[model samples]
Target chain A: MSTPLISIRDLHVSFHTQDGVVKAVDGVSFDVMPGETLGIVGESGSGKSVTANAIMRLNFGTQVDVSGEIIMNGKNLLEVDDDELRTLRGRQMAMVFQDPLTALNPFYTVGNQIAEAYLIHHPKATKSEVREIVLNAMVKVGIPEPTKRMDSYPHEFSGGMRQRIVIAIALVNNPQLLIADEPTTALDVTVQAQILELIGTLQEEYGSAVMLITHDLGVIAETADRVMVMYAGHAVELANVDELFETPTHPYTVGLLGSVHSLDDSSRGALQTISGTPPSLINLPTGCAFHPRCRFELGENSLCRTEAPQLHAVGKSRSACHLPESQLLQIGAKGGV
Target chain B: MIYFVIRRLLFAVVLLFVVSFFTYVLFTALPTNPAALTCGKNCTPEVIARNEVRLGYDQPIHVQYGRFLKGIFAGRTYGPEGASVHCPAPALGYSFEYHECVTDLITRTFPVTLSVAIGAFVLWMGIGVGLGTLAALRRGRWQDRFATTFSVVGISLPTFFFALLAILVIVIWGGLLDFPQYTGFTENPIKWFSGLLLPWATLAILSASTYVRLTRNGILEVMNEEFVRLGLAKGVKRRTLIIKYVMRAAMVPIVTIAGLDFAALLGGAVITESVFNLPGMGKLSIRAVTDSDLPVLVATTLVAAVLIVVANAVVDILYGFLDPRVREKV
Candidate 1:
């Protein structure tokens, strides 16, 4: 197999708030192969966005505490100096944020904002060259009338158009990896589809690895090659997108899949829901964080409530559950909790 | 833009007219008699009546008001026909106490107030924005605490008291500067600057406190904006991000407040000027009030009203330049 474009090892991100230290991202690890899209699916407060931010070292300067290895291009991102990190940011890895409305500077024109990203990396580029690159980026993002729209302010554009401008800025330098955190969450359903398709098309064109973070299962099923299910700051399951859907081993993953309303299964009366709220990050349940919500029966001397489950191989996927694989497979085949 | 300016200007004219009318009526309604004051203490009732006629005070209120408005557009004759004094058009009024045109008094003293205001404006904005930026950048640190303390003192202390305290400390005690005296800028720029320094520092310190708080809070708020975060994530240098993104967003409201504050100061730093004993409009207005100089009071009131109106218009226009969202609508 080809070497991974980026590798995260035992990453932990926490924030010291007025209340206490909130473990936003407990020990978690993953990898993204070059040119492949890895979908990070989780509920809110699951540290999905925090994990993406850690890879880019975006949480630095803030009160967030990050300790882990984010190895990209033979350098630990957490250990690189600010100057080196800046050089790699827009040039080696760029991020597309969630809300385009506020993400783009309202005071600046779309063209100027896009040109800024290019200028930061290529400080010596001439004005005309910079303009050409900016216009080209605008065109590549499918923004209509690039020359005219470039001078327009962000407020003048619709939400979708603003997102396009944001994407243009992120991809202007053609970074090898693009981390998109809920890029479509703020957009309408139709616009969301267009934006996702645009990202997919751009990934193919640039051949850049993508770390797509979202809470939408359909989005992952349609776009992601490999899927990682996170619950309460822990990655509970990891598998190929199809394999995970066919045999979700973790109880939490099984509950998540069961909750989605399948259009094809018209006879399914009511959507199944997990039994409890996500455990607080500050004080998680002992053993498995999801045990309070798990429906499967406890085995003899069951460690489900006394010990945390670590990710282990089960068929073609990896899961963090004390439950036996055969029992999970049976639950998966049933397709409901 | 031209239409907007024209509309604002017309509105200012109407507002000035209303303000001047009120000033005329209110000052005239004072129990003191302007004619009797113009006449000597030994004057008789007959002499006062003749003086009243000569001064055009005998006319009905509305007619006198009409003549006052007319004096602004066309010169009006004062005293009897043959011995009449013809003040030029745009003549605010004739100040009998000073034996000069009210317009002339303002024109002469305006430069002093202008000098004080302009210098103070520069000082306050520089210190306020500079310290504010520092406080915001180093929030919760000693520098921020110091700035907060400075602002608190500024807001709490009365302008007159602060001006006196500044005089007592910087001039009488420290001997670092001379007492404030009004000197025309054209007469001797050095003396003009030195003479206004105390007033400038007094006003700047008091006013800068507000701006320090404003700029500090404004910058802190802008720094939290998502656009600033995006700028940082774009790998833009820290200095560039602060300047282009953070400061740009923060400066919009500051510009508006600064413009209006400057306009108010230009009308007259009433307490500051009085404390400094500068021969500005504020001192003249106070003297006019004590002497019951009706024309001078009306003229000063009109000038202040006009300044505030013009300032509001200018601030609105400046908003267009500072914030793009306001540009099209403005």
Candidate 2:
């Protein structure tokens, strides 16, 4: 994979609030190779966004505690100072947030904003150079009439267009790694497809490693080269996208795919749903975080209830579960994986 | 934008007319014999009758009101027939108590009040917004708590009491500053500043507390907004992010209150003026009211109404400038 562009190792992030310490992202590890798209699929509060933000050291507040390595281009982002991080952040890596409505500052025009992003890092760049760079970025992101549209404010653009501008801002510097955290969640269905296509095209053009975080398994199927399924702040499954979908070893991953495919083919009967809600991060269950909701034969054993399980290699993928492969195969056949 | 400003200005004019008319009607209904008061307590019936005619009190209320409006546009006359006095355009008639032109009295005193208001406004805004920004940045810490506590005390304090305390401590006990006095800025800039320094501080300290709380709350709210987070994510400098994104957004609400407060202060911080013996608009208006000088009172009230309306219009315009969405809607 040519020395992965970003290698996140055992990342942990917890926010201390009055209620308790929220273990948002715990022991999550992954690598984004050059030009590879890594899809992080998880429901809300699964720490997908937190893990991505930690790469740029962006998730900061009074009581936040983030530890472990976020190695990008040989530097550990977690250990770097703020000044270094700032310079690295738009020049080497940039982020596109989930909601386009708020991702761009409303006060400035589109062109001005894009220019500022480029100018901050390239402070010595001339006005003409900045204008050219900004206009080219706007064009690359598919905004029409780069000259005129650049003057328009965010409110003038539709939801999809705003998202395009946000993408433009992120790609203005042509960063090697792009973190798009649910970039299309707030978009309409048709617009969502277009934005995804736009992102795919831009990623190809820039040859940047894209970390696409979303809860939609369908999106991961269409976009990700490798998939990581997270449940309650932990990566429960990781494999090639095809392998993960063809045979999901984790019980939680099976249930997630089941809930979707079951709805798709209703002839199979009513939609199947995982029974219990995700456990609270503050006071998680004693065993595997998903044990309470997992539907597997060996899940009834005292070991599944009292002992925590780590990700273990099984065939082509890793799964965090106590169920043996023989038992998972049978369950997968029954569950229509 | 031009059309919007013109529309607002027209609306203000109509509003001012309505306000002045109502105030005139209410003032006329007070039942006091203004003519007899001007004629003196020992005056005979002939003197009272002459005073009534000279003052135009014998005319019907509607005629008097029409003349008052007309007098504002053109010139007008007053006094007995043998010694009729002329008032120039935009005349507000004569003050019986001060025996001076109402327009002249207001014009002369307005500059003093304007200077005080402006000096205090600059001081309070700098102190208030600065403290607020600091507090918001250090939210949940001792600095924030101290600012919050200070604002509460400031908001609860009476203007008169604060003025007195400033005089007693800064002037009498400490002798660190001189008592406040009015000096024309045009005549001597340094003296003007030094003379108003104590009053400026007193006013700034009191009003700054309110602004500190306001700015702190506004900034805190804005810092949480997604746009601000986006700015941070963009790797913009922290100072640029706060000033351009967070502080600019916070200024919307603060500007609204500040505009109105500034206009109100210009109309006259009466207690502050009186305590400082500045002869500013506030003290002038108070004297007019106590002396039953109807012309001065009505003129002062109208001026105050105009200031408030102008301030409100300015705030609306600023709002449009600050938010493009608002600009589009307007």
Q: Where does candidate 2 stray beyond 4 Å?
A: A261-264, A297-301, B44-50
TM-score of each: 0.95, 0.95
After TM-score superposition, what is the CA distance of residue B313 in candidate 1 from its true location, in Å? 1.3
TM-score of chain A of each: 0.97, 0.96
* C-alpha DockQ of every model: 0.73, 0.73
Off by over 4 Å in 1: A297-302, B1-11, B22-26, B29-33, B80-83
Instruction: Report the alpha-carbon TM-score of model 1 versus the true structure.
Output: 0.95
Query: Best lDDT goes to which candidate?
Result: 1
| Candidate 2 lDDT tens digits, B1-330 | 888878878888898889888877777767665676665568898898888987888898888888988889997887777766788978887776776778889999999999999999999999899989999999999999988888888888888888898889988999977777788999999889988987787788889998998999999998888778777777899999989999988998898999999999989888888889998889999997787778787888888988998899888888888888788877
What do the candidate models score in CA lDDT, each in turn?
0.89, 0.86
